[model samples]
Target: MNYEFLRCDIENKVATVTISHSPGNKLNTQVYQEITQIMGELEANEHVNAIVITGEGEEAFVAGADINELADLDTVGMMDLTQITRTSYSKIENLNKPVIASINGEARGGGLELALSCDLRIASEYAQFAFPEINLGVIPGGGGTQRIQKVVGQGTAKELLYFGETIDAERAYQLQIVNKVVDQNELSSTAKEWARKLAQKAPVALRMMKLAVNTGANVDLESALTIEATSYDGSFATQDRKEGIAARLENRKPNFKGR
Candidate 1:
């Protein structure tokens, strides 16, 4: 599908999605709709084993939501907008393939929330992060409150959300919000490298592992264990699992057909 607010490219089973709504990449309802469609396409594309999301330019991954659009939103409109964005974010979170947020620059408010939904985040040295919705007389509406706490601690999430404070890449790395912080020049290469590595893994195992972790996170320990066991058992039935075992025995690389 043609997209005005986003650009997508796929190579070697890795799909890179770049938000280009504006220089700051501030998201709006239209962007969320586009994201939902893009995600659906990626999910159906068997060749796409991993995904990477980032901003178009170096100035900002996404500064926040478009204030102009927010200014016009009434209570009902806000709720609708929130639902749309939340659904889009949830799609990224629940995708069987791993989604990596390549934070090329500042990611604040909704921008930060988008990154939080990803399975992993790799930020550049120049990148910054914040949950500044409080300053706007609103709070994060796109699963940020939950995901951030999962990535960082509850205390840290509260402090950041309550104060609307911004942190640089170093502090974000220390807080465990980002998986890696690299020089700006290396940001794209690093993110792609990670995606490519994931793409080469046993596809069925990758999907099942993601399902186990995400589905188990909200359940009791015993239930979570059961979920993992179920996923593990299902993986054993895949042809890739047999190939993986055979390759290990032969000391050769496995060519998983994503079965």
Candidate 2:
């Protein structure tokens, strides 16, 4: 399907969604709508086993929300805006297939929030990450505060959000916000390499693993174990599991059809 604000390219079961609001690539309401629709299609596409998200230009993965559009909201309006943004971002996290962020350049405020929404983040050497909402007399309205806290811990999260500082890609990797950092020229290829590797794994097992990590975080110890048990059972029933073991026995690489 053709998308105006984003581009969708699927190759070998890995779908790459590129945010294309050029120049700074700011997220406006139209951009949000496109992102929501694109994610829905990627989730429903049976051939897509993994996904990568990035920006269109070298200047930004996303700079932030369109400040001109965002600066007019009142308290109630801001609340409503936050809810929609949260819902859209949660859709990516809860997708059955993994979604990776290949951050090509500057990611600030909502841009960083968008990156955090993905299951994994890979940044270009030239990428810059910041949460500058605090400097604007505001804070991250998307799931940024919550998700960043979860991944990088409360103390580190507080420092980044409160200070509104721009850190390099290497610094982000040290904070564990970015999983990998590569040369700007190699960023897309590297992210695709990782996504293709993920696509080669058992799809059912990958989904269950995502559920365990995402859902179990909020549960009690026993409840978490129960969640894991269900996930294990779900994967065990798939043909991929039988094939995985059979291939191991024969000392051959498993052919996973993502069934």
Candidate 3:
């Protein structure tokens, strides 16, 4: 399918979605709509097992939202925009297949929020992260406040959001926001490597694992354990489980059909 704001390329069971708005790749209403639609398509595409998200240029992963688009909005319009943004980001976070953010450069405001929605983040050495919404007299509305706190803890999340200060990739790694940091030249290849590795795993098991972790994160310990156990038990019924065991005994590589 054609997209106005992004490009989706699939290879070796990995789908890479590039935000192609150019320059800063700032998110506007069209970007949000395209993201939502593309994510849904990727989720339903049987051949896709992993997904990667990144921006088009060298200067920014995504600089922020389209400030020009936001500048003319009334209160109701702002609410509508935030709702769409939140829904789009939520789709990324809850995708059955794993999603990785290959953050190449600056990620500020809604851009940082978008990265936070991914299952994992791999940032380039030149990448920077911030929630600069406060500068515009607003706060993050696209799950940033909640997701960042979950990843980096409350105090650090508060500091980043309140002060609207940008942190380098190293600092973000230290804060546990990004899973890994590499040179800018290696960012795309590294992200693809990880995504391909993920694609080679048992799809059903990975889906259950992701489901368990995402769902359990919000519940009590006992409830979380119950959810995990349920997911674990459900995995045993898949054909992939039998193939995995048979391959182990035969000393051959397992062929997973995502069944």
Candidate 4:
């Protein structure tokens, strides 16, 4: 499908979705719509085993929301916009395949929120992150406030949110917001490499693993154990499970067809 603000390309079972806008790749209504649409297509595309999201230029993964759009919003408009944003982010967060954020540069406000929705984040040395919505006399309308705390504890999230300060890639890695940080020149290659590695895993098991961890995280210990048990039992029923075991016994690589 055609997109005005987003570009998608698939290679080696990995889909790379890039957000590109003239000024800082800021999130807007159209961008959100295109993202959700692209994600839907990717979800159904059997060839795609993993996904990576990033910005067009090296300057920013996304600077924030488009102030041009935000500036024109009334209270009702703001509410509607926030709902759309939330739904779009939810689509990414709930995707069965692994989603990685190749954060090339600045990720602020809603941009940071977008990155938080991904399963993993790999930031460039020049990358910077912040929730600067408070500076605009508003809070992060997306999942930033909640997701950030889940990844980086409440105290750190509170400090970052309250101060509206930008943290460098290293600091973000230290806070566990980003899984890895590499030199600016290595960012794209590193992200693509990681995506390719993830694509090599058994597809059904990868999906189940993500589901088990994400679902378990929100429940009590006993409930989490139950969720994991279900996932574990479900995996054993797949043809890939037998192939994996037989390959191990034969000392050969397993060929999982995602059965």
Clashing pairs in 2: none
- Report how far off residue 214 is in candidate 1 (Å): 0.7
All models: lDDT?
A: 0.94, 0.91, 0.95, 0.94
lDDT of 2 by residue, 9-88 (tens): 99999999988886788897778877888889888888999999999889999999998778897888778777778877
Q: What TM-score would each prediction reach against the true structure?
A: 0.99, 0.96, 0.99, 0.98
Residue 22 in model 4: lDDT: 76
How well does candidate 4 match the true structure, expressed as C-alpha RMSD? Answer: 0.8
Model 4's alpha-carbon lDDT is 0.94
Residue-level lDDT for 157 in candidate 4 = 89
- Greater lDDT among 3 and 4 belongs to 3
Please provide, for model 3 over 2-94, each residue's C-alpha lDDT reduced to its tens digit, 9 standing for 90 to 100.
Answer: 798899999999999999896699999999999999999999999999999999988999999998999999999999999999999999999
**Alpha-carbon shift of residue 52 in model 1 (angstroms):** 0.7
Model 4 weakest 10-residue run by lDDT: 132-141
Q: List CA RMSD, all candidates.
A: 0.7, 1.3, 0.7, 0.8
